[model samples]
Target: MDNKIIAILCGLLTCFHLSTAFATENGSDSFSLGAEGIMAGALPPAGLYFLGYYQNYHANKFIDGPSQFYVDANAVVPRFVWMTNHNIANGQLGWYVAQPLVDLKVKINGLNDSNQGLGDLYLGTMLGWHHQNHNWLAALETVLGTGDYKTPSQTHLVRANIGKNYDTIRPIFAYSYLNSNGIDLSTKISYSWNSKNEATNYKSGEYFAGDYSLGYRIQPKIKVAVEGYYFKQMKDDKDNGKDIDFKGQVLAIGPAIQYANKNWSLEAKFLKETNVKNRPEGHANWLKLVWAF
Candidate 1:
């Protein structure tokens, strides 16, 4: 069984390299941030696992405004995970609070000043199952949010994930929905692999194009890591007046480094759009921090 796991990991690593080669040929510098907070757990435990994270986003185009920018600061406290001792099955229940504080210095080209506020609030939860190999895992999760934003616009989300690990290689696939007044579907796949030199101290791995990362353990008290990812936009309902649509999709990527210990941790990542679909004003970066007990 161990040998089989090792083989899978090795195959995954090779695929990672091959994917990178293909991405390079496409001339796409797409990148993604490494998984952050406790969602990036090494393995599932049998007891209650509590996790939380805070992310701040600065964007010029959250909607269809001019060069407007806003900071979205969100925190999820005590998101809980429960795993049965049997290991074949597990469940997760969690909630999060998000607030988008906006500062629109440059009014959109046409929109009025009355179309602004402190942003909306959001909350969510999930459930999952584990495979017997200790290498494969899968789950389904749902999230909903309400507040002033719920009036004209509300947030609803549902997602499914399948992930596998082989020794030092891990790959994840997820399908998600962001439904407010309009519905948005997002599909994403990512992989991570440990570097060849075990003694190098940093676990180096690369995901699609710009999604490369390096992680190092800082003794008993801390660990530091850095990573990046690419953002792409799919088709939306701009032509169909029934649904909400933005100018265009923006492609962005950035690097982030983090420090963490047993009781607490801090993370900071910067993201910028490399590709602009239709909206040029919708480009910005952000930073985030998290804590747990």
Candidate 2:
């Protein structure tokens, strides 16, 4: 019968590309506060929503000592969403939360460094499965500390996403893992679990990341994206005894632009670190702004 109808249409197109890569690995960026889609356009039973953002960072290391530029002023950065849709067990469910409020400053190697504090708080969830044209997603996220002032030392994240929605364009892939513990501020110490000395009690360590995205809408509101990210940092019992080895790696690439309607939305992003290891003043650059309801 025509070769069994072309082998059942090539096995249903390879299960629809593995269910859109597992719905873009579970859709993240912390509920779209980071932008790129996967929050189901603002999930929930369809009620209560909010978002805000602001970010900035600059660096220069043509060959110097330290100093890497920094600036992050956040105001009312918040997000909360919930959505549900299950008709006879078809699929659709999501939840989200986000918070930000920080002010930072640095000059490095030349002196002048400051940190106001309050950043890092997120929670997310998603589940989708409905095929008629396309639909398949799975996601999970976490990063909570409930910041108030000095933050860092609160980490927990898990992700898996896969997406495919063609009509305009939607491509996503993600994999994430993070676990942090190490913070005891007295004076000079930021990130890397507060410069671990033994990390006295908070015992710092953990990081593993991955990201990839492609979204283009242009019309239905507007969308644009290009992203890449990778990070690794995990090795500390105080590094066995410490001869002199910290272990770090980071790579970043970016370009993002978004605009939405139905309520309000606007976003911008730019990241470039190319590649870095051990810490070359940790090259960096960032910019962000978002608002939603």
For residues 2-101, write the lDDT of model 2, one tens digit per residue: 1000000000000001111111111111122223321222222333445444444334441222233222223344455555454324546556565555
Model 2: residue 243 alpha-carbon error in angstroms: 6.7
Model 2 score (lDDT):
0.34
TM-score: which candidate is best?
Answer: 1
Please report, as a residue range, the 10-residue window in candidate 2 with the lowest summed lDDT.
Answer: 6-15
lDDT of 1: 0.29
Q: Could you tell me the lDDT of residue 8 within candidate 1?
A: 5
Residue 66 in candidate 1 has what lDDT? Answer: 28
TM-score of model 2 relative to the true fold?
A: 0.24
TM-score of each prediction: 0.45, 0.24
Q: What is the lDDT of residue 250 in candidate 2?
A: 51
Candidate number achieving the greatest lDDT relative to the actual structure: 2
Runs with alpha carbons beyond 4 Å of true place in candidate 2:
1-48, 51-202, 205-237, 240-244, 266-291
lDDT of 1 by residue, 134-179 (tens): 2223322221111122111122111010001112232444332222
